[model samples]
Target chain A: MSAVEHAVVDQLGTAEARALLMTAEFGRLAFIDGHGPTVEPFAFALEDTAEDTAIVIAVGTGSGARAAVGQTVAFEVDEIDPVRRTGWSVVAVGTLHGAPATVTARPEPWPDPDGELVLLRLPAERLTGRRLRRETRRAGRR
Target chain B: MSAVEHAVVDQLGTAEARALLMTAEFGRLAFIDGHGPTVEPFAFALEDTAEDTAIVIAVGTGSGARAAVGQTVAFEVDEIDPVRRTGWSVVAVGTLHGAPATVTARPEPWPDPDGELVLLRLPAERLTGRRLRRETRRAGRR
Candidate 1:
């Protein structure tokens, strides 16, 4: 009989978490809207500032995301292999704000048939990550 | 020169959104933590009751997700093709609650090295989704 595989979850440190965040160009942004708490996927780019790294996203002027400015939000990114059921996820918590004039490395804006686009930045105030690894264990083993 | 491709975003209806949600086995759950808002990935399954569908997840006793019970939360799932820059994302907003004994279709719990596991349920009060499609346009075309 084939050995059963179980997942082992590991917590990642700050530096390791930030390193992992840099590897993905897309993420889900969670914020509160009129209805309630909601999440939307966005293309993101990391910018290095004098103090820390910031996540930048470009959205249309009429986008509900524009309202997220000044609000605390969570940005999450992950890479999962469904067949293997193994992956790592990283979440950055911070306040969303309008981008400064000096900001660089903006994500390419999705074509907006509505109006112009604007850039929003979120300084990763706190970072946490976890990795799930599957290991083979003999069947019936506790 | 080859035509440039631009992303076109489309909003999906409720039936379409729920159907898309059923196609994925994993998703990110966003909830408010002690520090602030945060997100974590988890294995999830959809359960059908007489009235509506519910999203179910299993977590260890020590899991922070337990705290999310009774609070409004957002569960998001998406499938993105990095190379093609095309995919769909669905988000369900609802209050988290402890699973009832009558509930069925529990997700397989991730191995917990610490303790026992429990199931949590979130009845998808509201469902929303969007799809990104890449369409090629001739150069200099508006």
Candidate 2:
């Protein structure tokens, strides 16, 4: 009998999703640029407060991420093992905004001696995640 | 007395960007779902022809990728070293469509015994990439 591999996907709750997000240092930010929809990687930090959790990123003055402010965007983080074909992904959707003075923790700006930088924050308004698992089964098995 | 690290970002040509893309096994797909803009990772294979190059991904029936058909999307692949804080990222923007019969090579779908799978293709219409390097300088040194 031949064996076939199957994938099982499970949905994680908000707490689990946020927990997973903390394990990753960087994530892809999806938003609409002048050309169209685009995704870029950004190093981010999580800002937790009694009110809400926010994704914070620091971008240089000329960075496109500056335009993303005031727009709804999705920040996604994941850890996957391509060899094992197993991993988990978490997506946080919310409106991007200028970081307020009260936000103490901010993502470190990349070394940019001449370029000014700004902080953008995205509160985790809607969080969702999925875990992928693989199992091998004999094709003839019931 | 102290040193500062700065990031230098370089833009890569189309040919070089495509070369870097070939080194990665998977990428993140950014598209707009009913909820809003979102991104998810997928295993992808590059379909190179005399005419053009396409990114092929196989998804199950329940995959949100199904709704991405006919929409403009961005596929990003990157290799980053968090510890060193340096890496390269490539973004391929294109329109998504159902894979054609003429297409021979396709991405492998995750094992899903109970779900039917379909193939989707995104031709690399506009490709852009950036390489980030770090340089450390003594304080107040040019």
Candidate 3:
């Protein structure tokens, strides 16, 4: 769609990208339903050794992430500054599967689960990223 | 991780969230890495029909989106006011798969090759979202 290009520029290479994934802790997950597509933001944990993999934070008896039990999935992680209008974004896609309920509930799902909890198996299929750079739109009819 | 907590609140029960997947338009994909997190805006085509429960937006080959072959990814869709710190975000998680090299060879990736392009996928897990009602520290501290 025309909108994507207008929003970003100068994408990064694979290595630069994986580095970003390793340190980040939260992002968004999207799903499609009968009405349309739904996108939601959530927290995730990545394997300490792997740079581009993630584990969704569990939220209650696997009931939270059960929605993506057998569906393809995608996520977006980025940092933005509302004041300057500058930031970068990375996109991820993969299949999401629940981690199967833990035999006995651990009362708390997250290390700090005031209440929210969720878990997911994110396997990346493709990885793409871009950097933020200012460029004037080409001369054209507005 | 704290930043993501707010994101989870907005999408918890919002089935009416926006991001016209079937409109054949583009949106933003946000991700995290060493640079914290980033956002890239791009365009895409809704590859399937409205009936397809799993919203699949095909990213043609050779485009930056193709880089998403096997990496953790997220997509960010928001409305821009350019003056206020008020905007919402929706993210999806998944990996990009091979749809045939021909698909990647499309003339343009996002409406334009030189423009930024972000990709997204629907998550299989239950959707949980948080909204930033006010700029305040997360309750009870994580």
Candidates, DockQ: 0.61, 0.63, 0.10
True contacts kept of each: 0.66, 0.78, 0.08
lDDT of 1 by residue, A1-103 (tens): 6587778888899899999998998888999988898888888899988887899999885457888899999999888888787888899999999999998
List, residue by residue over A2-43, the lDDT tens digit for candidate 2. Answer: 998778888889999999999988888898889888877888
Candidate 3 per-residue lDDT, tens place, B69-132, comes to: 4545554454422223234543444444444432322223442334333333433232223333
Model 3 lDDT at residue A135: 50
How do the candidates score on chain B by TM-score?
Answer: 0.92, 0.91, 0.47
Docking class of 3: incorrect
Order of candidate numbers by lDDT, starting with the best: 2, 1, 3
Q: Against the hidden true structure, what lDDT does model 2 obtain? A: 0.86
Where model 2 places Cα greater than 4 Å from the true spot, the runs are A1-5, A111-114, A136-142, B1-4, B111-114, B138-142
As for candidate 1, its clashing pairs are none
Off by over 4 Å in 3: A1-8, A48-52, A60-65, A82-85, A100-118, A135-142, B1-142
**Model 2 clashes, total count:** 4
Worst 10 residues of 1 chain A by lDDT: A108-117
Q: Summarize candidate 1's per-residue lDDT along B1-142 as a digit string, tens digits.
A: 5587777888899999999999999888899978889887878889998887889999886457878889999999899887777899889999999999998977977533347778889999999988888888778634
